[model samples]
Target chain A: MTSSDALAGHTFEELSDYLDRDRTPADPSIEGSPECQTALNGMQRLRSVHRDLLLKDAQRESEREDSWVSSILQHISLEARAGRDIPISHSSPTARLSVTEGAVRGILRAAGDSVPNIIVGRCHLDGDVTEPGAPITVRVDATVLEGEIIASLADQLREALYAALRQHTELAVEAIDITIRDLYQPFVPPAKASSDE
Target chain B: MSDAPSPDPVSTDPGTSSTLPDRLDKVVLAVPGVDELYSAAPLVAAVVKTVIATTVEAVTGEQKSNSSVSVDEKKAGLEIAVKIGVNAPYTAIDVSRRVHDAITDQLEQNGNPDVAEIAVSVARID
Candidate 1:
């Protein structure tokens, strides 16, 4: 295959798609070409940026929200699976109410976030979420704002999270355990502003 | 075809109601960690409205629809939904919960019942 011909038909985007699917139905000509292999390598490197999962980490070092945060948010799922149905008191025996695991997770996140300077990270409901009244553990990792008292923040987060869960969900939470994952730096004014004339 | 009045451009903010939507709008916008509130309009109109609202708010201390409210004539209630852009430092769910509580409180305080449902969509994180 000529150097240009190797990548002529399939765009880099197409080849990346092909690579993602294990290059199924491989075209012999592209596979055999050194030039094609080089282009594929370049495409792989580009994909690695997203693969790295450049999360927001809520860095407010600027006026606008960071561009990376917007990108990450676009890919996040809002309709996370709601767990099995938990029954509610209905006059009609057939009437039932249920909340999903996703909904429960939403509650947990909300509760944790309610606490000042606390942003919840990964949240897990670590037991049989499907079984009603089953004792399930809630575990979450959170980031705290720098300079905040850790003990006080934890206490506040615990209280808010508990209240939110109680008000919203029927889950018999066995325990809510929060692990402090990271501390974010507070926004600092520019040196130009701070400099005494 | 079911006979239905082309429901007045029933925005969550119809702007017809004097205090309820206006009061709720004030309370929602007042919440901390709330970066933005949503409005409905064509691209050009929304932009124009935003410009005007921001300008007026600066001078009059009265804000326009960051959120809106509408009533369903058939149903015995009103449904309110608004898109909010909030801080990433806080959780969207928490912000929504806060906003929900505030709106509910205002609606009840105003003696308005049939506030059937309120949905706070996190349109962006700032």
Candidate 2:
């Protein structure tokens, strides 16, 4: 490609390399004028716009109210409550416990309660608990469980499942399996301290 | 005790009345992240409050309000906050960072800090 056209794709450093090596066209045409310095200016403008967009995005993120988180949790909980039953195939197992991703998220949210930065991942029930007398094992993947929070989450899940089971049927929970999949990093808001003049 | 007569001070200075508010508006508008400069009424009132407070403090040499700034992101795009008595020196950077941080914190806390653009303004006491 021609030098000017090549510049459109190449960064300032690359273009500088071409100029330093005298590979740029020697013609005095406006397209190839040495007096017309344009590459870095365009890059600077582009960089400014990118940074502005980031700042704007950050501002938008900080201004959202609590309702958003609440709504997301509510939606997940609703989905979990309406658990679907996947058909048991062949002779592998007769009991089936199928839960939607939404329900799992909801259960996790319920378990998390007011805990911040808690995220739920893959969830599976180990044992068959679909029948009235069958024992069940609930396996959950979670992040951001520290110290007693894990135990607290487990307790919260037990209560949630117990209530859910009581409402749906009379199946008793044999064991609650909680696997700590991930940990969440707590986000701290920037401090606005007044600088003394 | 010369209590015979007191000349009435000029209460109608057109230049002061006309230019002061416009200057205040310009100063407020000059602060970065201030979008739709005309649409900020509550913020304008807050600025006026700050200006008056600052002026009173300057006259009496007494601290009237704390130097802290409070941000409230309600209806003005994504993030919004008000700085009552911002100190000098790092006024520009402080205001900019405070607005940015307020918006960022609120969005991060609420779980969607990457969707919208936020605007902020500062209100300084006189």
Candidate 3:
């Protein structure tokens, strides 16, 4: 498997297929590897957010560009690899504590997703993240649900991300730059809506 | 720092009760924010080890322990490594620290082997 498609030797397609199977008859290889698990978590969350829209989009494939979703998937795959080890300070000389870059990125996405009406896209941690006091800048792209004021939503997302980073990582966050990439309307499964009606 | 021989270095038998790596794995999982334990070794190495272990198990009818924690006995002291997944609402930073402390405390209980290093990394956050 090529590096772009795989995490820890398991391809992203394989991981997605595992999820599609509802993770039944669990694969030890995927379960044993942290990078694969990290990627799976990201893909699972993305699938959950896009479930209805995915169904709709599938039926109308040509109506809109699916590039955004593809971009997010690519980012998730890239970010899930165990990158640098961000050291955690400890008094004891023997204690070598750290949080992985993958884990930090995962939490950053989760924090951004926590803001209602927004789905976090690509997350980038700039600067020397391996260094404890380095000035790190968090740049993230997000898609806001239609109807919410973009400025307010961006502010909310930025704050949520900042708080999560502060709580989970000791990075010297210089700033959080949020880009409003697109707007998506919530898709209510037509079948469900018709049944309700 | 007791100059004791390394206690249960790479306990390969999962059936062996209370192996050092097994005990450490349990302790890490029990930590509040720890969602899952993953192999501290790199992915390719872990896969190869698993394959070899399975073959060994099939041939000898022995259930080899593939514990995620790695423990090494060094001239300096005991070296332990662990990777874990953190549950949301519980930050990875705090969870990793907790795991480190827990491992240290466990080792202390087991004759206080001088710890040269206890490397704990949070691999995922859910």
Clashes, model 2: 19
Which whole-number lDDT from 0 to 100 does residue A137 have in model 1?
Answer: 82
TM-score for candidate 2, please give it.
0.27
* Residue-level error in angstroms, candidate 1, position B9: 32
* Model 2 whole-model lDDT (C-alpha atoms): 0.37
Query: What is candidate 3's lDDT per residue for B7-122, written digit by digit as tens?
Result: 55444334555578878889989999998888888777887888888999999987677778999888897889998888878876778888988998888766677778999988
Looking at model 2 chain A, which ten-residue stretch has the lowest summed lDDT? A87-96
Compare candidates 1 and 2 on TM-score and give the better one.
1
lDDT of 2 by residue, B3-106 (tens): 75432111212444322223323444455543222222333454455577689889998645422223223443332223222233223234434444444444
lDDT of 2 by residue, A29-104 (tens): 2122111123322222223433443344345656755323223322322233223332111211211212222223
> Model 2 segments beyond 4 Å from truth?
A1-83, A86-119, A145-149, A193-197, B1-126
Q: Which regions of candidate 3 fall more than 4 Å away from where they truly are?
A: A1-5, A63-66, A186-197, B1-17
State residue A43's C-alpha deviation in candidate 2, in Å: 38
Which candidate tops DockQ? 3
What is the DockQ for all candidates, taken in turn? Answer: 0.02, 0.01, 0.72
The model with the greatest lDDT is 3
> What lDDT score belongs to each candidate, Candidate 1 first?
0.53, 0.37, 0.81
A-chain TM-score, model 3: 0.89
DockQ preference between candidates 1 and 3, better one: 3
If ranked by lDDT, best first, what sequence of candidates would result?
3, 1, 2
Task: Return the lDDT, model 3, position B77.
Answer: 79
Residue-wise lDDT of candidate 1 within A1-197, one digit each (tens)?
22333242444446656778877888644443223343453334324432332223334326555343332222122212223433222232212223334445555554554566666666677877657688978787776778999888988888887776665555688898888877765545445755565
